[model samples]
Target: MEAAGEPIPLSALQHAVYCLRQAALIHLERLWAENVFTAEGAVLHAVADKGGGRHARGVRRVMSLPLASRRLNLAGVADVVEFPRVGGQETPFPIEYKRGKPKLHRADEVQLCAQGLCLEEMTGAPVPQGALFYAATKRRVVVPFDADLRALTEAAAADLARVLASGETPPPTPLKARCRACSLHDLCRPEAVARPARAWRDRMVAAEVGPR
Candidate 1:
């Protein structure tokens, strides 16, 4: 967890889970570039930002809802929040929009959980669950605000705080598929930077030890 009054963007947690260097580049270094994937995501967010509220049946739908959590020191916007009025009671839940499919990492889930945390703070109500709307799948993946996922989300926030406190970009951890998919690949240039640095560090170590 971050020290008091040191809030970071909730999106930074998603970036950190995807790649520490990527998170540092965006949040710490404040650099960004748009690629095909990012552009598509921007387009999706544009639609989400239409800022209209409506009700269907017993459910109230809100778009582009701002959220913040002082406990977690994170803030961001939800794509949609659904308040289902069931049996004269209402349960408010978040739904995030993603342009792509789910990945092996906890990036998307952490983001949604962070929103739930924010909602709980703002509404003073318990948020037991949320959903992720994947454009490719055209489905909602329900995510329970369980202890494990909450811990992961909090840990991600702390990880981001550490990165920001250091004020240094993290070294690139280049995996072929991950780097290839990352929109910031051109800016980060892991292959051009980190691999060569590793080689130089290896050479320095070898020189110091001498041949046995």
Candidate 2:
């Protein structure tokens, strides 16, 4: 359970980035509905969460690595972290598993960056980069933890903390592409609520402007 002032879940940061209302629904209201997309994601995670370690090609691979960052107050489990020899020393490299390919949104990248943040805190070593393995594409994309990404991750943590602390569900502003794919679409009913909300906004604007 998470309170307004408690440590935030790393997943919540991703959710917040994707959609604030979605984050509020999941973390604040404890609502969830599994669709095919979510189901596929769950299956992909299931395979990675076996929780063990092994060495491969001189690289030490760890699965289901528990990660926490006191600095950012974020916590979550990494799917896989490979400590490969870099410059004659092992460096932590996190790899996240996703169900789909990369999209326009930066949610997935932000999620992976958050994991790297946690690893740096725990291991007291610099986590310069990570990777995202997309099941749909069957490809891995390397992500550099650059200034922009680190800043975005920090901002997401703050936004998520505020949403959870407020404990209020945000109104729906549905875009078809995202809403249709969301697991909570049935419960969110964006189409049902968005029109009326927009109408109210129009009315309020008219009231403010008088006649213009």
Q: For every model shown, what is its TM-score relative to the native structure?
A: 0.89, 0.94
Question: What lDDT does the true structure give each of the candidates?
Answer: 0.86, 0.90
Q: Write the per-residue lDDT of candidate 2 for residues 148-170, one digit (tens) a residue.
A: 99999999998887767776788
Runs with alpha carbons beyond 4 Å of true place in candidate 2: none
- Tens digits of per-residue lDDT, candidate 1, 74-135, equal 87778899998655877789999998887788889999899999998998878999999888
Residue 24 C-alpha lDDT in model 2: 86
Error of 1 at 120 (Å): 1.5
How many angstroms is residue 205 displaced in model 1 relative to the true structure, after the best TM-score fit?
6.1
